[model samples]
Target: MFLAQSFVFSLLAITGLALPSNEGVKHNNMARSTKYAPKEPPLTTPWTDKVGTKPWPEYPRPLLQRSDWKNLNGIWKYQNASDLNAVDSPPFGKDLAQEVLIPSCIESGLSGIQTDWGLYSWFSTSFDVSSEWKNDKVLLNFGAVDYEATVFVNGQKAGFHRGGYYRFALDVTEHVKFDQSNELLVFVHDPTDDGDYVIPIGKQTLRPSHIFYTPCSGIWQSVWLEAAPTNYITQLDLDANMDGQVNVTVHSSANGTSAQAKVTVHKDGKTVATHEGPTNKPFQFTVSSPKLWSPDSPNLYNVTVSLDKDEVESYIGFRTISRGVIDGVERPLLNGEFIFMFGTLDQGYWPDGLYTPPNHEAMVYDLKVLKDLGFNMVRKHIKVETDLFYRACDEIGLLVIQDMPSLRPLQSVLPDAKQQAEFARQLDVLVNQFKSYPSIAIWVIYNEGWGQITDTYPEFELTDRVRQLDPTRLVDSTTGWVDHGAGDFSDNHHYANPQCGTPFYSTASSPYDPSRIGFQGEFGGIGNNVSIEHLWNNQAAIDTINQTYEIDTTIEAWNYRSHLLLGELEDQIRLFACSGGVWTQTTDVEGEVNGLITYDRRVSRVDEKQWKADIQALYDAAAARSSNSTRDSL
Candidate 1:
């Protein structure tokens, strides 16, 4: 009965459904803690119950997926210790004091243990190896761990990784006890603003208030295991040219042995191209009558790669993205056609799940809602999300502008040598990890002046490095404040008063150097404190809700403010000639009520139809201006 009701509810959600008022549901004392037995569950999404048995059970890496893999995300024994030296000793035999949900962070509500225990936490679990994986190398893969993570297998150290935002794998072939249960343990340490190191920690604050959010710590993503042959396909690089051909590179490692690879591309369940190449070289093949990928039609071609005894399934889209001058005005072009890039600032935060969503459907829901609202692009602000997010964007045909997570303490000077090196290493890893996704069009190296504050502007060098690494995509050297004469776009930020709407948009100031494209990186932060009557009757939300909203005048003021905000948006896009613009945010984060949707994602403050119309008008106007077409014709 519940499943049937849930299905009905989803169907109703597509058009729009009025939410039940704040009543009936019981509110519990749900304070965040690190204790074994906390008061109660924190705020939960509608998909909470669906996170049963094996949460995030799907293959962690979608671009390179295999059927033979194990999900280790259900339950794991966890122990929190203040002593930093707890990682020296192996935790294979010790009994942990508590059990926490894997993949979700300790600070999140869905993790079972809603806590802020950021550093020196140990987690352990045991799993048996299948008979099919006996002769192959058993590989342990971690989707991501905050800050630093060290792993141990059966009382022996397997490997360690430094970054908190990228995936890393280790080959545990020799250490595994075949066919028997083997103990696995991992220790994580995150200095989330508590330490003196300069690491990239996008928007996380020790004392969170206003724009800063709760610091996520320790195992915030998925962990799993897979079996691969000694001679296997390690990585894939895909590039589709406008000339009806794609360059496919299959990276294989045979442990000093030779291997041959066969690549095949399929469209509409029919084979379109095939090539056989040496394991070390890339193969090029042509697709006859190739269908291009765009927002209107996100056509994807399935790829099958076979290397000796190993086989993997992947997908790619053929599209071209570039910046060009059309009618004397420069704009972002898609498939040799001028396009106006309008997008939202997505922080990738949730009330229940910090880094991870409640379920896969929830991730898709966010993108779907935005797409339905007539958005063609999204600027993933600061943090790097899981592979599922990029995949969802790809399938939904939403262009993505990925930001390199910024460092903490808000420095006005350049980072030290060691920290700079660390940032570069992580940046390289970030590009290599998600570069295969065709949805990702822009790589933002530094945001505002978070870490690169030197007069020499180190961001220029960083942007050059990124361009060299992934020349296929455009690079935005800095988003808001500084531009060191590098990258493809010159960006600016604006927040003008609603009372001065037309004047503000008409005469807005930005650094528009003729050599690069122009972009309004961020603008318009119109606050609308949600009415308590509209929220769920749960104490989980009591802390994040604004007490000032209790006043009736505040509600009226915000409603009028919403009208003014819309006027401001209309004027900005109608008046400005920038290539694109990114609004402040998509959903309301804690303490910031400026999002189009509420933090819970249950309520949209603005009228949905009007909002979509306004956004579409902006796109059409920009397209007309670039193509030198009259607005009436558009």
Candidate 2:
């Protein structure tokens, strides 16, 4: 009886039609007739138009590559539920009234349906499995979905995932028909600062203000389908270090225990090393005279792991991030040498795409521009970016200090057991998922005490667990306030105060512990709303400048003040002997106008050549200080 029902459903779906339900709503399975046109945003990049019908066509997962895959990042039917309770059932065969671009959030202008807030939304699309993939298992992957998501393949529940910033996959091989069209339906519920449950929401808020911006409600990253053999590599954990030692562990989906993996390491198209090892076991290989990965020389070694019938390609870079005592002062070290991590606080938000960048080129442009400006590192502030962003960093040699998104404090129903457990689980998933990226040097567990429970939050315990999970990288327990001094760096955040001779000042009166490296986590928030045409909202910018900075000044005056603050910050860094500092931001977000670059990305507030030279001078001064201190100690 069940087989007959499924067969009838498949036949109806394949015919590009659906039966009318008892509710008198006619269901249409035909392709959407509505054309996609992104809503006119306040600002857009050159690559905005390049995000055609099929956006983010590039393979989403670079670390784990396969020749056979399909990008499901195109037009999809969508329906906004009136409330959370209205999303009780999946709209299996119902025709959605609206169309939206996949990957871009419903709130983003790039999604075409830029509604104010969508707490509950449904998205449906149809895809056909290739004939060649008939013998292989089909995996449906979502880069990320805000809050909670329930997926259905051909009206059958496939999987459910909760987390706004982590990737999730559902094996829909059995649920999908190989020769017929398969209907994919996703129900998303994201209560951004409106829910009773606590989830990691970062700086997203429905009510946008000075610091917090608009919420990314639903699917904000790429969705795709991948074909894999039954005995395929599910994951590859590569641990490559500066000592020329490489450990490869392959996690597989094989039911039998007899599968062995042949691993090959390549450098510059030449095979450097190979090792055959059993699946699910760690195996070792060595590369002699390894070219260490650094900001100046970002060398990556290509790797391929082949099982009996499944093979996957990946890449790894050899580097180590640690803290070392240099001339009796602790400092951040890359590959056993002190390297100043001059960086910017990069909140990954776009005017058009919100949490998602318009396209791959737009994403690369930000990192490339930072690199060209002589900045070696970036603090990915409060948001986990798509894998492509990290891949670009790896290739471009920009160090990343990845921050875990914080939960809303006053809004969320926190201090409960369930919310706390969810936070911990999501944190674990985040660490395990992004541990393979060599560009990620530090894992910031908490930021500014946003969601921390002062007395009972277990900050130290959480920090220890993150360290245990990935001992290769550093773990920062607290980035700003409520520091338990539990992690590698005693980090702090301070904005520029023009009243002081040194605009940048640390809140801590006493010196930081000599055991832990002192770090200026955030500073230099100098408002430069220079380009009037590129402003997201003119009045908002004016209000922000007035309320936050309390200054009514001209563009030239603000820019001059910015340069003066930066000069003072350089002196402060030298005086404090801190490891590194991050300027408040890279680009202006929604209302907050204090950015080095304009929100539109078309205008640079500072002269690029002069900024680069100034940044290089900071690096030179830091290097000179290290050398002089060592000489004096000798």
Candidate 3:
């Protein structure tokens, strides 16, 4: 009934008519047509709010924010291609008859068009370019578009992007009409598990029965426009060294090769350091007394960069991450100190928005809960999130283990060159997109054996590529199952307990052996209870290895069961002597109730206070070991 009313309100607003009072009339799902209103199961989060004209109005890129940008994320005209071939043609004059919400996946309930099977989706909208931006170049940015996207601005092809995860931008200055309104049309094609392409699908299958959930297709992220000077700063990379030095690399674009970059670092709004260098070269700077970034003290310094006629603001946190021997155990070190990463596998799924969060506050709430439960890290499983999500992790002081979304067909033994190259290219793009975020401490190139199925895994090649791209952070070539002796650490996945003990603490047998630091990439998938009211599929089998309480639905019973499950994690961390341990999940995804929190974010299965205390005790023990290790070395 709630969904039906929302649809009615949407239709009235789209047709430029006011909604009537909601008094006695009741509207049912049977009356609404799927063409106008999709028939999806009604599920909502507490963060659900009336999406006004401009949804997600916050600056999409918080780290590099500007005041001159305009948000293009409100209602957009959309049309699903009746014929797949129609997508190849430009959608300049074609009429988009249906209305859809921007930035939300079409399969999600919040999108207002919940049909997910469409291979080609077209979006068109008119936006005005401010006259103040006449002297600048107009840049159109898409936070993300799934699978493949071809963009057209005012009847001209502007740009094309292949990967669905990372952010991309196109200079629309040549395609835009400065004084008049500009028409923007984007065509997105996503072959999600349909066998048309072998790409990273990441827990999305067409037949989402047990472990997998629904597929997110087309424009699942924000789209916006920014006006920048013709000569602008394109990218910035910052690496903090353990010796109190930071390497700053800046890339800039200009009409000629004479542009130089001037950078200034500010601490507490006071200038601390400054450097001027060529746009193509890196600039090194040092501080007298550096304040490192950690869960305890997340100190960040603001920076401003200027090149020719452009200037942008950015911030960085000084920290170093590596793997080393500590207390006779191989462990991950942060800021020259060994730290055990106790985290959860965050799938980044929502009950309402599927891929996109309902609002910025919704994203913040997830991080807050993780921190409240005494977690120091989050292994972002398989999926690459928006820049805002990474920013939230940085601000909230949560370390990240970013995983490359797995390409499907795990059992296959042969490697395809085209798929392999595409995967590598996308991995490079992912690193370039998120390298500026200090929260990301490790990168997982492949998950289990999904994409790395060959006898000799090619992850060594991918791992080498990632290192060449960004050598500051550590890399786990493959998370679990079938190690081909590459990357910085060895990973194991087990249920309830990790069996690969002690060997990882010793020296490597061969110099080429990459399995040194042991990490429990995935474990402890314990399901407590399934809330029938919030179940996406009640009949679906619970997707977990260990079921704590098969039939317990009461809060008391679920809490008791979850307490025991979380307690097991503390023992597993020490018993395995792991550098890091990521729990099965942070929240329950569809058809899977193994998360510590419920699917709707309404209930935590365990007592928060007790869970925090237990996790904190483990953290205390790990710190003590690190201190002892330092003393022994001295």
Candidate 4:
């Protein structure tokens, strides 16, 4: 029987649904330990104080949202595991001697237990199933768990998940008792860079120095509980464009023969479009004169999908990112117009939280500051951030060049079959997971030859797969490496200054592919320590700051170099007709002091007015050159 939405709670009470009982489940009677306290960091953000008992209380997944959910992101019992065999025996119903904060990595200062616990660790907490959710399926959702995680509920092994950068969930309805406290335990194993296996560790390393950073092990994202109907909406694939046509695909857990889907799109609280169809089927609908999304005007429409009794809310922006001939040269186009993608290499890291941000505001603040400084884009350098970070970009109208986290040690030899399969699986996940975000303009496959298979075949294959999976966005096969001559962008990297004539590729001469757009993947390190007091206390980082190409000890010298470098970059776009470029970094990270912003984000190393003006000149130069070309063609 179909129950009305308003009477769902009342009807569930009298439904007489069979609920799990804790008949044989043992209960822990020991008192909770109070040993957990956030370790003091060398640098702290304003949001540090706000991260009290509960951090990241907001819903983790903004793309697919539910109104009723439980945030399990607070204090949790933790203990170090002696060996890998610990997964066989979880300390069920037993009190752990130590505690740590949820979502933060064990190596982070915010996690309380900042000591690295090697390969294995265990986490335990308890949550209650609401009586209103009696007939619903209780989903234990994890935003992300580093490396691998084994989950248990009520002493029963629920499920296991691998891959540190992707989200996963387990249906715990069978093990959870309704209207009662239920024990939930998770065991995590992260080898990081020390393991023999070739995993996508990005920039994490056991020994933190230079570009590699401290490893963020264990659960580094939110843990939550969501109640859903037995037959629910699993996923939504939306393909929106500026021409007012939207292709919608709704995936449901139920059989499509009987299930029905209703989609409604709203603009400014008014219904703009609606469609009714069957589940797991692709359908098309159109909006009247859609407002396109871009860095200048970031417009989004709220969407609601209903599948029988289950409903979810999400939002989408209409935009098209592609390469087109502009001024007789190929250039990146946003909404069919040439726009210079002036950006920064954004390493999404925080001193207090490590892989995770101190809070959502702190994450948004970084992007917001970039936008304020006239940067329209950010290349998320080799790090897959939580959904909140991308959602912030979607709302703030900042373009994102998302890089696939690569394996370590810069592989020159071919990977084994097992390693290749794992890399492909993670790459697939990275592409499919973030494809719905309109702000993501490009997908960067490999960076600077790290973990590259040393052959063009595998690189071409991976790039082809990403293109097939998401044909809407452009793909960058390899950035700053042996330019496999694949994907849409012929990208390259240089330091301290802009290289206009030909990009410096590591393997061979820079291939001038007329089919691909030219992009400066990285340039302009231009280091300046704005404040020594706020600098990272690492002596190696302090001593090595002057070793870079352009290390300015004073503000005046830094600003002068900044203008000169930006002027050269402007010429790269105007004189050489380069499409876009990414500056070295958004903020200084640990031992790498080459950032426009300091490591702690407390001070800006550049002269703000000059920096903003210089960036604006790059766009103006591109516009002027494009205009001249168009006039000449006529």
**Candidate models: Cα lDDT each:** 0.74, 0.79, 0.75, 0.81
TM-scores for the candidates: 0.87, 0.91, 0.89, 0.92
lDDT of 1 at 355: 78
lDDT of 4 by residue, 162-245 (tens): 899999878899999988889999999988876466788889888777777778888899999998999887777887888888
Instruction: Report how far off residue 454 is in candidate 3 (Å).
Output: 1.7
Q: Please, what are the lDDT tens digits per residue for candidate 2 over residues 79-154?
A: 7776666556667887776778999988876887666677888888999997789888899999999989999999
Model 1 Cα RMSD, Å?
A: 8.3
Sorting all predicted structures by TM-score, with the top scorer first, yields 4, 2, 3, 1
What does candidate 1's lDDT look like per residue over 301-364, in tens digits? 8889899889999988888778776555556777777677778899988777777887889888
- Between prediction 3 and prediction 4, which has the larger TM-score? 4
In model 1, state the lDDT of residue 627: 56
Q: Candidate 1 lDDT (Cα, whole model)?
A: 0.74
lDDT of 3 by residue, 1-634 (tens): 2456566654554466854432232333233222333223345678655554467987888666666898999878776764457656655665565667788888777777666475777888888897888889999989899878889999888988998887888999988887798888888888877765788778877666556777888888889899998877777777766566878777766534655788888899798888787776777878767778888788888888878778888888888987777766677888878888878999999878888888888888888999988899999999999888888888889999999988884566333788778888888998887888989999999887787756556888888899988988999887776677788777777664443333332121122132377677776666666547665532443443223324346767756755665565556456656566788778888767777887888877767777778778768666666675532111
Query: Which one wins on TM-score?
Result: 4
Question: In lDDT terms, how accurate is model 3?
Answer: 0.75
Model 3 TM-score? 0.89
Residue pair clashes in candidate 1: none
Model 2: residue 571 alpha-carbon error in angstroms: 2.7
Q: What lDDT score goes with residue 286 in model 3?
A: 87
The TM-score that candidate 1 achieves is 0.87
